[model samples]
Target: MGKATGFLEYTRINPKKRSPEERIRDWNEIRLPRDPEVVKTQGARCMNCGIPFCHSGVLLNGMASGCPLHNLIPEWNGLIYKGQWEEAYKRLTRTSPFPEFTSRVCPAPCEGACTEGHILESVTINSLEYEIIEKAFAEGWVVPRKGKATGRKIAIVGSGPAGLSAAYYLNTVGHEVTVYERSDRVGGLMMYGIPNMKLEKRIVERRFVLLKESGINFILNTEVGNDIPAQELVDQYDAVVLCAGATKARGLDVEGSQLKGVHYAVDFLGVNTKSLLDSNLQDGKFISAEGKNVIIIGGGDTGTDCVATSIRHGCKSVYQFEIMPEPPAQRIEESNPWPEWPKKLKVDYGQEEAISLSGKDPRNYLISTKKMAGNEKGEVKEVHTVEIAWVKNASGRMVPQEVPGTEKVWQADLVLLAMGFLGPEDRIADELKLDRDSRSNVKAEYEVFQTNLDKVFTAGDMRRGQSLIVWALQEGKLAAREVDKYLMGKSVIK
Candidate 1:
C-alpha cells in the first residue's frame, strides 16, 4: 500500500547505532539518531502483498509468520511512504500500547515474514516502527485518553509488559486499576532481567511516569501470595489479572552446581543492573566479573546478555554454552518459507559486542557441562565441558548425544546460569489451586484468560511459558478484556 514502486526501488536500511565501545561505557540506549526521510525510505520497502503474514503471531511449522498483535503493517508503511508520520504513528498505537519496547527488543518477526525477505533484506519495518513511535512521543501526540467513568475496579499482578498493557487498556476504559509488584520496582523482568544496554531503565521509567500520570495506581513490594493473599485481591477488586511471570529459573543438575561462585542469571542481572542504576560503578555492591574468566550456561537472550554484561564488566574472558546445535544462517527449505519465521543464525547485540571484545564468537553450541570444578574452599574454580552431536530418534526428533572423547575443561572464577525459566513459581499456582497446562504454565484459554479458580485470571509468562514481551503485552490486553467482561458482563476491548 506504499508507493507503487517504493518496494521495488529502495533497499532496507537500519538506523545507525553507536559503536559498542561507546555504548558499553554508559547505560543509555545503544541507538543514534536517524533522519525521518531515511526512515520513510526504509518503510517504503514494504511490498503490498495480498496476505500480510507479518501479524500472524503464531508459529507455523516451528517458525513465526506474522505480527502477533496484527499490527497494521502495510497501512502504516503506506502512510510513512507518503511522509505521513502522524498518521503512521496513529495506526501503530491502534494495536500496540508500547511501540517503543517492541522497537528495541522484539525480534521483528514481521520483517522475517515479509514477502520481500524471501530473496532480499526485509523492509526495515522495525526501524520504521521505532521512528513512528519516537516521533509520536516527541510531538506530544501520545497523550493518555482519560475515558468517561466505567466505575469498575481491577487489580493486576506483576507489573511486567502484560500487566502494564492490561492496565493501560483497562484504565483507558475508565476502570480504576491498581498494579501490584512483589519486587521493590514496578517492572517484573523488564526492570531487572534485561540488561540496560538493550533497554535503558530510563525508557521504562519514562513510560511508567506517563502511566502514573494517566491515573493507574502502582503498588510496589506487594506480593499477591504473601503480602496480600489471592483471595484478598479477589475481594478488594472486582477482578484480578495474574501476570506473575515464569520466574523459576531452570538449573543444571551436574556436580558442583551449588558452588558459591555459581549464580542464577536473573539474580546476577538484577543485582548488577540495579547496582549500575543506584550507583554508577562507584559502589561495587553487585556481582563483579572484573579480571575474572566467566562461564555462562545457555544460549538464549539472557545468556547472550550475560556474555555482553561480562564484557562490560571487564572480564578477562567469557564463554557461553548451548545444548542445541547452532541454527542455519538461512531458513530451512523443508519447514521455513517466505511468510514464516526463518530459522537462522542471528547475531544479537550482545553477541556482536562479545565478538568485538573477544577474538571470536563466545558460543560453544551442542555442548554440555558435566560438572563445575571447585577448590576445597567451595568456590567455583573451573568447569568441565563436553561437546556433543545430534541424532534423529525413532520419532525423527533430534536429540543430543555426547561424543566420548570430546570431554574438555575450561577454567573460570565465576559461573552464571542463563538456562531460561521453568514457568511460574509453584507457590502461586499451589496457593491459588489453579490448573496448569502441560507446559506447567497456568491453564487459561487464549482471550478467555481465566484461571480454574473462580473469578481469577492469568496472563503473560505465568499463563504462557516464557515468551516475547510483545506476546506478553497482547496476552495481558486480552486477559484484561476477559476480566473486564466478567466484571461488567461485556467489553468493548477484544
Candidate 2:
C-alpha cells in the first residue's frame, strides 16, 4: 500500500461530467477531462484489505461482485498513488486487454465490492482505469508487440471484445490470426450497438489500428456463415474460435409490435451510430426520434442508452418502463451484506439526462406493456401498459400478475424494445452444426471453451449468453489457451 491511512484520509471522487444542457445538443462524450491529482487521490482511497474482494470476480445473487478479469486492483492503486503511471498501466494491461472499452461502458463491479464501500463510497476504479490507459496511449507506451511466426493460421469469427482479446493473446503466442467481421467496420457492439455519446467510435478505431499494426488481419464486411462458408473456415484454419456474441434480441410479443415506429433497441442504436460515422447522421438512414414521444421498454443499460439517445435526438418526451419493482436506494444490510454486489437503485447517465431535461425521472417501475396502438399510416402512436404485482403462483414462483383496472395509455410515436438478448443468433451455430445449450447459447464449458465439434471453440456472449465485456475478455483469454493447447497439444498462454 502506498499509504496505510490513505483510505481514511481520502474520499472517492469521479470525473466531472458535461452539463446535460450543453451535452445534449451534440454527440460528443458527456465526460469532462479527468484531473491527474484527483485520480491519484481516488487511487489512494483503495484500502489495503488483507482479503481484497475487489478482484474476486464472483457472482453473488446473480450479479457480478468484482472485476471479472480479476484485475490486480490493489497493486495498480498503489502504483497510481505512488505516481508510477507507467507501472500502473502495465499492471492494468496484465489482466485487461482493453481497459479503454471497459473503463467507458462497464458497470464497475470492482467498486461495488470495494472494502471501503462497506460503509462509505467506493473508490473510482473505472475512472482510474480509464486514466491509466489514456496516459499509456499519450506516452506512446502502447505499441505493437508481435511474436515470431509459428507457421500456423487461426481464424476468429467476430471482432468484439472476446474475439479481439483472443486474437491479441493468440497472435502474441506466434500464431497468425485473422478476424472476420460482418459489419464494414470492426468492434461489433462497441462500434455500433453502443451510442457514440457513451463510447466514441474513434476510440474503437484507435484499437483497430493498433491491432492491425500488430500483424492481426481484419476482414471487414465478411460473415462466416454467409459470405464465407463456415465449412471452408473450419477446413482452412488450424483452429476456429467463435465470439460472434448473443445478438438475438428478445422481442415484444404485444400487439402492433410490427408497427413502423417500433424497433429493437440494438437496431435503433446500431443504425444511429452507423449513420453518424458514415455521414455525421445527415444521411437520414436511421430511425429518428426527433419531435416524437419515445417509449423504451426495459430498464437495464440498453434501455438507459435508448433514453439518452432519444434525448439527443430531440425527442419530444421519453418514458421508460420496467417490469420489475424499483430497487432500494440503499443496500438492505441484512440481505445484501458487505462485499456482495449491491442490488440497489442506480441513476445512470441516461436517467440523469432524462431528469435534467424532463424535470423528473422517466422510469415507471412494476409496469408491463400490454400492447401498442398504431395510426392509420401503420405507425405506432400509443403504448398500452398495466401495473403489475409480483405474487407467488401455484408453483411457488413469483410471477408478474397484472393489476386489474390499472391499465393506462401513453402517447408514443417511437417504441424501442430493450428487453435484452435471448441468445446467439442460431444461424452460425446451425450452419456449423454446433451444439447449443437449453437456453440456445453455444454449448461450451467455461475454461475449456471447446464445442462438441473438434477444432471448434466458443467464447463470450455467444457461449455464456449476454454478459459484460470483462467476462467476454476473460472468456476469450481462456478460449485462446484452449485453442493453443488443441493446436500444439500444450499452451503457454496465461
Candidate 3:
C-alpha cells in the first residue's frame, strides 16, 4: 500500500536466472543477484487487494489457493517497496521458519491466488520472498534468541521441515527442545533428497547454526525407534513429537523391476547429494548418473529433480514420463475460479534445464513404462511403454484406458522411478501398534496431532503421507501445540 498507482506504474519483473549454457555445466543455484532497485520495482507491482487472499494459506476445493503457512505477503511487499529489508525479513520469519528453502523451491500458491493474477501477471511474490530472506542473511540481521528456560524438555523425531518448524516454535515458547535426525546432518529431506542446485546445503547449515545458538539441541545420526526406542523418548520427555517423513519411495510393480540399472529416485537423490557434498563426484560410493541414457518415470518435483540430477551427472540423454495427461498451458477450466491452484502445465527448473540442453521438452505426457527388456547378463537395456487416455467408464470414475496399437519401446540403460510415496514406513507404527489410514499414513486427525496412544503425536509426511514442505511445517506447529497442551494441561504454541 506504499504507492496507490505503483501496481499500474511497474510491470512485473522476476529475478534473473543463470544462463542455460553456463548453469547446466555445474550444480549451483540458478538465481543470480540483481539490483535492489529492480527488486523494489517488482515489489511495487502488489495491488494491495482488500482481501489479500495470498495470505489466507488454506486449501479451497481440494487445491491450495493461498500460502499454506499463511505468510504476511502484503506487509512484506510494502516493506520491500519502502526499502526496509530488515523489517521485511522479520515479518517474513514471523510465519515461515525457512524462507530460504521455500522461496527457492515452493510452487508459489500465493501468487496464483493473487488478485493481480486475474488481470496481469501476479507480483513476483516468490522472488521477493527469496530476496528479503537472503538479504537478511547477508546483513547479519538474522540471529538467535534463547528462551528463559521453562524446564520442560521435548524431543522431535525427524529434522525435516516439519520437525524443524516444530522445534523452532516449541523453543520459542521457552521449552527445551532437542531434534533427532537419522542422518549425519539436521535437515532430513532438504539436506539429502533435494539437490544443491535448487537448495544449497549451505542455506540449511546457516539456519542450523542459528537454531543451535538458540539453545535448541540437535542429535545427528541418531535414529529414534531404532537406536533410541520410542518408549525411551516418552519416558524422558514430557511429550514426544514424531516428524519422521514418509521415506518409503513408491516402486513400480512391473516386470524386471529387480533388474540392475533400475533405482528408486529418493535413494538415487540421497546418495548423489551426499556424494556431491562429500567429494564432488570423486568417490563412486553412491549411484552415479554419469554418461548413461536415463529414463525418469513420474512428473512431480521428485521426477524433475531426477532429470536435473541426471543431466548434471553427464547423462547422454534424459527422458521424463508422466502418466497424467498434459495440463492446460494457461489456466484451469472456467469452472475453477480464483484462489484455486491452477492446474496448468509448468516448466519446472529441471524441465527448463532439459529443454535448454536438448531442443525440446523431456517429458512424455500420458505415457507409462509397462515393462522392461533386459540383456542376458540381467541388466536393463530397454523399456516398453504405451500411451494412455483417461475416459469415464459406466461407473463414472475416470480411468486410464490404454490406446490400442500405441505400444512402443525405448532404449534405456538407466531407469529411475520417481513415482510419489505410498505412506510412512509401517515399522514404527507396527512397533507402537498405532492405527493407520487407508493410505497407510499414521491415523492422526488434522488440527490435533494425537495418535491413538496417550501422549504420542505425529506430524508431517509420517502422518499425512507425502506432502509439500509448507504443509509439513504447519502440521509440526499444530502437533507441537497439542503435545504442549497434553503435557501442561494448557496450550500456547501456534
Candidate 2 at 385: error in angstroms?
A: 0.8
10 residues in a row with least lDDT, candidate 3: 330-339
lDDT of 1 by residue, 1-494 (tens): 77777777987777788887787666678888898678777777888778877777887766557788889899999899888889898899999999998898888888888878887888888888888888888899988666567788888988999999999988987899999998877778899999898888887888999999999999998888888788788887788888889999999999999999899999999998889888886788899998999999998889988988888888999989888889998888776666777778988777788877766898889899999989999999999998989999999998888999999889989999998898998777788788998989999998788888877889999998898888898998888788778877888876
Candidate 2: lDDT over CA atoms?
0.92
Give the per-residue lDDT digits (tens) of candidate 2, residues 1-494.
86888888987777899988888898998888877788888888888789888999999988889999999999999999899999999999998898999999999999889988988898888999989999999999999878888898999999999999999999988899999999999999989899998999999999999999999999999988999888899999999999999999999988999999999999999999999999988999998999999999998999999999999899999999999999999999899887788889999989999999879999999999999999999999999999999999999999999999999999999999999999998778998889998999999899999999889999999999999999999999999999999888898887
- Number of the top-ranking candidate, with lDDT as the measure: 2
lDDT tens per residue, model 3, 196-303: 899999899999999999989999898887887777887898777888999888999999889999999998999988888889877986777788889998888999
User: CA lDDT of each candidate?
Assistant: 0.86, 0.92, 0.87
Colliding residue pairs in candidate 2: none
TM-score of 1: 0.97
Quality of model 3 by C-alpha lDDT: 0.87
Clashes of each: 5, 0, 0
| TM-score of each candidate structure, all chains considered together | 0.97, 0.99, 0.97
State which candidate, 1 or 2, has the greater lDDT.
2
